[model samples]
Target: MRADARKNYEHLLTVARKVFTEQGNDASLRDIARRAEVGLGTLYRHFPTREALLEALLRTSFGALAKRADELQASSDSADALITWLQEIIAFTHEHRGVIAPMVSAIEDHESALHASCVTLRSAGAALLARAQADGKARADLDGSELFDLIAALAWLREQPSHASRADRIFGVISGAILARRP
Candidate 1:
């Protein structure tokens, strides 16, 4: 990819992310190209297909999230760090829910890159959870896989316009549960 083409591709990702958030998974690729000041050919050249675009968007977001979990682990109090990371993950899910839905559907049918990314995510989250538990700040019995499932459920709730507040409340409950003192 040449410098200008790379720039155009990055611009398209940014524009597509915003459009997907506002207009959802059904948002038009043509509109995305128009907003990015590119042609349909350029969009297809970069993304190839709508599913490809969605997967790339998901990978970008999930990569940032996994990175953030590492950063939080280094600086914050262990329990606070875990809770904060969970909150950020939930927010990412809400923002990318449109793209995530299809990726999730694909995973349900068979193994794919989406499944690989999910495995990576769970591994990262598990490491953080282990650190927190070892520090005696989080519930010792909490399983990372279970926590991840809860996060996914919460994220799904956040995708709905009417359930945003409900998602927040549920997050609070989960945070409280995980942070409760051990007997």
Candidate 2:
């Protein structure tokens, strides 16, 4: 891309992330274009679609999560590593208001722009989960997919206005279930 084009792309992405963070996925593309001082055609040329824009914005985050998984797998207690990464996943979900909905959908729909990254994030968590299970810290029956879903559900619950305060307790209950039973 040309220098001007690259600048516009990065500016659009910055404005889009701000708009989405404030007004969620429903935020207008036109508003993003306006804020970025770019034309709608330019935005379309770069992103093509809302999902594409979101995928572009989240690609770094997904990569970071994968890297975090690698670090966690060796950094400390297996259970603590899993818990820490789970919190990061939760925080990532909470970064934008409605992102979790699309993320969940993307996990199931390979046609979605975010599908591959979502799978990568899930597999990252799964590796940590496997390590936990191997260390006898987590339930062996639970796999990475299950753990990923559990974190998504908990993150969604944490966002709910009514249940928000109890999220830690809810997370605790789920965490307990994920742990192996003493013989």
TM-score of each: 0.76, 0.94
Q: Which candidate is the best by TM-score?
A: 2
How many angstroms is residue 115 displaced in model 1 relative to the true structure, after the best TM-score fit?
4.1
lDDT of 2 at 166: 94
Error of 2 at 44 (Å): 1.1
Q: lDDT of all predictions, in order shown?
A: 0.79, 0.89
Lowest summed lDDT over 10 consecutive residues: which window, candidate 1?
Answer: 104-113
* lDDT (Cα, tens digit) per residue for candidate 1, span 95-160: 665654664555444445466667667777887888899898888888878777777777888887
Considering only N, C-alpha and C atoms within 3 Å, which residue pairs clash in candidate 1? Answer: none
- Which regions of candidate 2 are displaced past 4 Å? none
TM-score of 2: 0.94
Per candidate, the number of residue pairs that clash is 0, 0
- Per residue, candidate 2 scores C-alpha lDDT tens digits across 108-143 of 999999999999999999999899899999998999
